[model samples]
Target: MKLTVHTFASLDGVMQGPGSPEEDPSGGFDRGGWVVPFMEEDFGRVVDSWFARTTELLFGRTTYDLMAGYWPQVTDPDDAVAAVLNGSPKHLVSMTVTAPSWANTVSVIADDVAGRVRELTNRPGGELQVHGSWRLVQALHEAGLVDEYRIIEFPVVVGEGKRIFRDGATASSFDVVETQVLGSGAVYRVLRPTPFTRGAFSVEDGRETVALDV
Candidate 1:
């Protein structure tokens, strides 16, 4: 199973909340629906594409709770996102959530979460997708587990909110494999993580040149 992350972020990398103002108010995040305005048909199509490859789901406690509160209520058969989320096998990473109320919650990893997830990746599946699970995403990133990132970057700069790559996050680079421009000025990007690289601009033989550190 390839671990993939799907998220909506602002231009400033804020991924706190993109659905509704009441979605995530953690740490007094007032700018919750920054990505709402940018959600057009193109955006919906991209989101649908993510679910098309989802065989399982990974979630942090908070994100799982948030999704459970909403997705289960959306019983629309035509809603691709809701259908996949409500029906897929979900793995929750939490100590407090001993028994999840959500249907199809197969397992909960309280201890040895990274190891458990590593084992999950070895299972037969297409994509074990993670959505809106910022904290879990951070841990997976640090564990070098995430295979790809599908992000929709809205053209909004949230002054302050929880960012995807917050300060002191695992320093890694990404190779942008795919990109698309939505009608609402949002950019959808698919990135594969890569090792962090460094380079320096120096004056060599009276010419400015870039010296890449190997």
Candidate 2:
């Protein structure tokens, strides 16, 4: 089982609420639903393909609360998007949430989220996917537990908002796996982590030589 993270962000790196104005306003963010109008069929196809390969989902408390409040009551039961979301197994990480109201949901409030997530990744499954949890994503990244990243970079730029990448976050490199351009000008990029190659340095005759081995 591999843990993958999927998220959308503005060109300026804002990952604040992309659905509704009231979804998140911690930083007085007014441009909440900025990603909807730009959504295209090509993007939808990309999401569908990605979800089809995922076996489970991980979400933060805020995102879980928001999604639980809406996705279950979606009027279009036949909609493919709703079906996938409603059917996936979800693990919500929170210290304050005593009970989860959503169906097919579980609560994981341990102090070591990275350890638990790594344990989950070692289990038998297709893919454990994380969505819309910037904080949690950063933690997992720092723990070096994320296997792949699917990022959709929108063309718009919001000068200030909650960003996907934060200061002092872990430094990890990736290899591009897939890239596509949506009709609405969003760029979809998929990346997989590559093994780190350590370099050796040797000094001889007052000169230094470096060699890298993978």
Candidate 3:
């Protein structure tokens, strides 16, 4: 199983709440529904494609509870996201949540976070997808556990909110696997993490010089 992170973000990288106004008000985020205006068929198509590859899900405590509270009630038979979300097993990372009430869910404490995730990653599967788990994603990222990222970048800028890439995130490089622009101007991007490499260009002694390092 490969660990993949899927998320929706604003142009400025805010990932607090994209669904509803009250979904997350942590930092008094008023632009919670910034991604709503840009939601269209093209965006749905990208999401559907992503869902097709999901085998399981890992989430932060907040994201887990929020999703568990909402997704179960979404009974639309044709809703691809709701379908996959309801069926896939979920692991919630937290120091608190001991007994998860959600079906097919388990609590992963901070001490066991990496160990549990690694166990899942070593399993044979398509993708252990992590969606909207900002804080958990931060820990996984800093631990060098995330293999790829699937993101929907909205056109609006929220200015202030919890970002997917937080301040203490690990320094790593990513290679764009694919990119597609939606009809509503939102862009869907697939990125694979890679070892950081660099190149420097310099003009010395009237000639251009270059140095590359990996």
Candidate 4:
């Protein structure tokens, strides 16, 4: 299984709550629902594309709770996102959530979460996707487990909120697999992690010399 992460963020990288104002208010974050104004057909199409590859869903407690409370109620058979989310197998990572009420919950991983997720990846499947789980995404990133990132960067500068790439994150680089700018000024980016690189530029013989360690 390929571990993939899907998320929505502001230009400033805030990914706290893109859905509603009351979605995630942790840390006094009042700048929720920033992605709403920019939502358009393009955004839906991009997100649907992500869901198309999802064979399983991996989520942190908060995101899982939010999704479970909402998506199951969306009993629209024609809705592709709701269908995929409600039907796919799910893995929740949390010590507090002992009994998940969501349908098709495979396991609740508390200890050795990275190890468990690695085990899941070793299994044969299409894509085990993590959506709106910033904290879990960070842990998986640190463990070098995320295979791809599908991000929709909205054109808004949320002054204060939880960011996707928090401070003191592991230094890394990504290979841009694809990029598309919507008419709403939102940018959809597909990125794959690459080895972190370092480089330096200097002037030699009046010409520029570049040195890089890949």
Whichever of 1 and 3 has more lDDT, that candidate is 1
Model 4 misplacement above 4 A: none
lDDT per residue for candidate 1 within 1-214, as digits (tens), equals 9999999888888899788899999999887877777778998888889999999999999999999999899988889889999999999999998879899999999999889999999999899999988989889998999999999988989988877776888889899999999999899999999999999898989999998864
* Global fold similarity of model 1 (TM-score): 0.97
Arrange candidates by TM-score, descending.
4, 1, 3, 2
Better of 1 and 2 by lDDT: 1
| Cα TM-score per model | 0.97, 0.87, 0.93, 0.97
lDDT of 3 at 36: 83
Give all candidate RMSDs, comma-separated: 1.0, 4.1, 1.6, 1.1
Task: Return the lDDT, model 1, position 205.
Answer: 90
Compared with the true structure, what per-residue lDDT tens digits does model 3 show for residues 31-104?
Answer: 67777888899988898898899898888888988998999999999898898999888777878788887888
Write candidate 2's Cα lDDT for 1-214 as tens digits. 8999998999998888887788888777888988988988998898888888878889988888888899899869667767777888888889888778988885565567987888788989999998888889888887888889999999999789888779877655679999989999899999887765577899989899887873
- lDDT against the true structure, per candidate, is 0.91, 0.85, 0.87, 0.91
Model 1 lDDT, residue 186, Cα: 91
By summed lDDT, which 10 consecutive residues of candidate 4 come out lowest? 157-166
* Global fold similarity of model 2 (TM-score): 0.87
Model 3 per-residue lDDT at 39? 83
Candidate 1 regions exceeding 4 Å error are none
Once superposed on the true structure, which residue ranges of model 3 sit more than 4 Å away at CA? 207-209
For model 3 the TM-score comes to 0.93
Error of 3 at 21 (Å): 1.5
